[model samples]
Target: MDLLDDESSAGASNAPEFSVSELSGAIKRTLEGAFGRVRVRGEVGRVMKAKSGHMYYDIKDDRNVIACTTWKGQVSGLGVLPEEGLEVIVTGKLSSFSAQSRYNINVDTIEVAGAGALMAMLEKRKAQLAADGLFAPERKQALPFLPEVIGVVTSPSGAVIRDILHRLRDRFPRKVLIWPVAVQGANCAPEVTAAIAGFNQFTPGGALPRPDLLIVARGGGSIEDLWGFNEESVVRAAAASDIPLISAVGHETDTTLIDFASDKRAPTPTAAAEMAVPVRLDLMAWVDGQEARLSRALAQGIGQRQQHLRDLSRALPRPETLLNTAAQRLDLWADRLPNALRAGIQSRQVRLAQAGLRANMLRNLLTTGQERLTTLDRRRPAALTRQVNTARRHLTATTGRLRLSLLQQDVARKSEAYGQLSRRFTDLARAQLQGRRNRLDTLDRLRETLGYQATLARGYAVVRAGDQVITTKAAAAKAGSLEIEFQDGRLTPQMEAKAAKSRKKPDTPPPDQGTLF
Candidate 1:
């Protein structure tokens, strides 16, 4: 109740008052005006992408944190997308949302804070990928000794690709397929990944042959400039590639995550080319050397075989000596041939005389044969009659089995079944034909209902110029001669003119002309 208290209360009452919305707005404006644009270096936390494609995340330090947002349109242009626990430098304008009563940054670009941050992220990613066995030696494929087609993924404008080509040409000329891509940008990872997958999609014997070896090459650059190769997407793609891949991302001193994932790693782009093919001169020299060795071995083998043949021949007896005994035996046999023949003839003559084989013995044999013939002739008629009786019985039995009535019955049964089947077939064919006719009629009706002629029946006339119908007034105006079609018939320009003439009243002859005035 003091006078000073009253003065203080009255002063407080005179102070300005604001609604919730106005106060929030005023604060937002002040905050935005104070920090229009800024670059904040902090560790990203709780990274998220909205369904609307805007990225939402928090950038925090030990003391405080700030909410950050990257609109969908600007996300792609960012050098790197923010991940949780990643320290990044964010560049953006400050913004405040009155509804949320909080200030946040509308991020324009985001990148790793420095090489240390990048290395830390790279190490984390490397550990994760290594745990997944992407760097396992057993998963790697051996490169082809000489690939028919070599696919290169690099920027076409860069000197790296030119160096690779030049090196390849100098070593051994090969068919090179260039899949041009951005080597160092936000687009680099996606484009290079897609190139690897696209090369794998080619059919082996297709018009564009599949590459036997893949070489992903890029020139030397700083860690940040070569970060696209370190991207998770690029590393994953390299590890998953079915084709043998050689990563030549940076100089020997500059290592990237892709080097560990690739099937082989080259220190430089030129080194990658060297790994892809062997020197032609060296290959030719090796081939010549192998040919010479093979020829010498062949000559040595032939000489050894000839020497063995001569040794074997020395152990064998001479042909004349081996045949000497056989010749002597042959001569002895030939000398005794005439005497043996004469002795055999004399012994055969003596045996013939002792046996008494003469004309009387022949007559006795003839008499015995005549007696045997007489006995056989006596039994012939009886055998012939018995055989005839057997043949007759067989014929009678066979004739009895062939009854005409049975054959007629079988024929009638078959004929009835055939007629039934034929009738059924005829009925089925007629039904199918009727169904087809009904379908055809329905289609014809549908065609008529949908056709423009049906529209003409409803008081609409179609104006045609030649065979084409004119639907618009502009088209009708352009038509030199109109053919108007109604449901009844078409009225051509000539027909219309004739009808107008017929409808016109006969021109009244000029009175002066008719009256001869």
Candidate 2:
């Protein structure tokens, strides 16, 4: 037994050991061989997307979690990205990442678990977006009656595009810009978003004419196939687009989020094309009808105006009759002019005869007045000489009295003015001296009130450290010594160690405050 055990121990000691990487690779090959392809049903969780166009996420059940990865090439075919909390069935081969030393699913196909779950998700997203006013009627734009250029977003090879072009051509031929894109897959949302944004980014009248209207169209399909149009990315892109958009994503019964966001919703791509342009024949007929109505209205208006002008012309008097009346009045005035001149001359003659009679009466009155003047002239010389001597003596006495009164009044007025001036000067000098005395007294009182000695006398002391006044306890604690000034004198206070520590509480009242006086 000892010999057998020794041989087994020697063999165990000689066995080879594998490194971490070698063991991981071996496990990877074993898992790949055992479960080459698998189908897992679980709720999605913790989805992470790499910038390299690769997605990494986990699918979890009540008890277990499995990591999943989808490469870029396969991602475009994924109708919808696996969102967190979404229940889906993943179909792919089980593979191990040797670098991470972990096993995961390399997913190639993902689908919602059931119709019920998909409907529930759709309803939830619809309610969430509807609450955000994405479907507001006020936000919908009016489609252009006739667009110069119509941009279509659909698969280039699909019959949907052909249907739209045919309908547009039949109604009214227009410039059609085709932006080929995936209509119902993982790439659909992003492609649609980019196309809508590209149309908006165009500068009008540039190398590429900016579209006046846009049509987002696709053929009818199952809910799963049409889900890309319902994606938040595509819906938001449509809502944010500047150009008027028409959504013809599926059959009339198929509703999507893009339908709510689009400016107009058409039952089919052909219907969308019809909405984008008006019928050329119908428009021409409408224009013709308007032209006929305008012509009739203009002719009727001109006839009415002509009839009114004729009525006004009949109401006015004839120009010849008016001139005949004027001529008759002129002839009558001409005949009366000579008779008026004769009457004027006769009145002047009567006025001249009255003037001659008045002159004769004046001559008789003048003769009477001259006879009376000769009687008074003989007695005038003797009376005038006697009156002149008496008048001269009275004038001399009146002149002497007037001179005496004038002299007395001048003397009295001068004496009174001199006395008043002397009194005013004395009063002014007294008032000026009083004002100066009062101002000097007020200045002296103000000086005494503002003086520091006055504040000290009021039970306040100025504490100084060197030349600076110490207003706070912190300054006193920092100083080696302090000089306290009172109204009577100054004293030097020595700071104790306890006082320095007590100064920490600056808000506390000083212990020697009561004894400061």
Candidate 3:
């Protein structure tokens, strides 16, 4: 039994306590000297990365964040940046940093416990920038619709590059130049600031003109991944640059102080890409519509010209109508002239015939008048003498009757004168009777002396031709026969003229006076 007890004691003394490296490491990870699985809420300060690819930062809450380190490979997939005043929950073993020999948490798995913690620090920074008027709307830039050059501050090799390319290809398809920049991590702010400045300087003399728009973009991640855009220097560079900027640094749900400072904000890199370019199909449709309108205008102009020509045609004059009217007038004149001339000739001929008949009648009447005047001259004086003698006889009878009546008015004168008057009257009557008988006998003798038939009976001759007496001696002597007139019978005489030497002369008779009554 004493030997069993001795074996138990000896085995217990041989048992392993711990290796010194393990002992010190375990001792370093404890409740008293270690900060174990505790949640720290603070703002980050002095954020850094070592050459071995480890990230170190302090966790602060308005004042501090204890020092901590994450191995390069472990934090390689963080897809975010660690920065000052970042709040997180760290699960790790506490250990000494050899350079300062100071104890700190070697971070294992870390999580962002209070995102508002970081926001509180960012809000304070935002207020400071606002008080300085750095984030004022007036301080912001304006974006260009058609940019000749585009500067991008984002991960060098990321999906953001492809997104912008796809958008440019579909929209503008113009020449573009890209400048690579860091999108996240400790060096992101300075690197982005440098890239913006370098692009500005190089833009003046480069193949591409200076950027009209600057697009800061990155793939989606935690808020820390997009924090580079929040840095004051990066923001001021974006604002101060001559170019306009588009902030597309995070997912649709994320927002930052840089968004207010930019000229425009996009939900994501893809959204930024879409905003930069236009669609090609819409331009083609507009060109086709313009062509159709031009074609319609040409058609309308042609129609107007055709109507004008039609109007002009109607207004033109017709020479044929004027000629036809003139011809009709000429034909009317041709039909009337000959008839008028023939009628005028017939009227003139009829007038000439009438005038000739009137002239012949006048000539015959003149010849008859001359013959009547000759007969009247031969007989008119003798008839007037007989009428005068009868008138004298009537006057003598009337005077005698008037005297006889006046004397009968006194009986004594009648008786006394009657005896005387009877004797005287008887004697006177007897004498008057004898005188009247003698006068009557004388008138009978004168008749016998002047009558042509009585002169033929008394052996007288009258030679006449065509009722005219022959009075000339030569006319009577050369005649073959002469008419002899007597008181009772007429005889034709043989008229012989004696020779000129045998002719005898006759004696002259005495003159007588007219008898008184």
* Highest-scoring model, lDDT: 1
TM-score of 1: 0.59
| Cα RMSD, model 2 | 42.3
For residues 1-517, could you state the per-residue lDDT of candidate 1 as single tens digits? 6999999999999999999999998998888899899999999999899999999999999999999989999998898888789999999999888888888999989988877888888899899999999999999999999999999999999999899989989999999999999998889989999999899899999999999999999988888889999888888999999999999998999999999999999999999999999999999999999999999999999999999999999999999999999999999999999999999999976755543433245445545655665575566557656755665555555544465455545556756765576567557655655565555556456556756789988899988899997889999888888998889998898777889999999767666535555
Candidate 3 runs further than 4 Å off = 1-113, 140-142, 287-517
Best-matching candidate per TM-score:
1
Encode model 3's per-residue lDDT on 463-500: one tens digit a residue. 65334567898887766566654455444543334443
Cα TM-score per model: 0.59, 0.57, 0.39
Clashing pairs in 2: none
lDDT of 1 at 295: 100
At residue 233, what lDDT does model 1 achieve?
Answer: 87
Total backbone clashes of candidate 2, pairs 3 or more residues apart or in separate chains:
0
Alpha-carbon runs more than 4 Å astray in model 1? 1-27, 50-52, 318-517
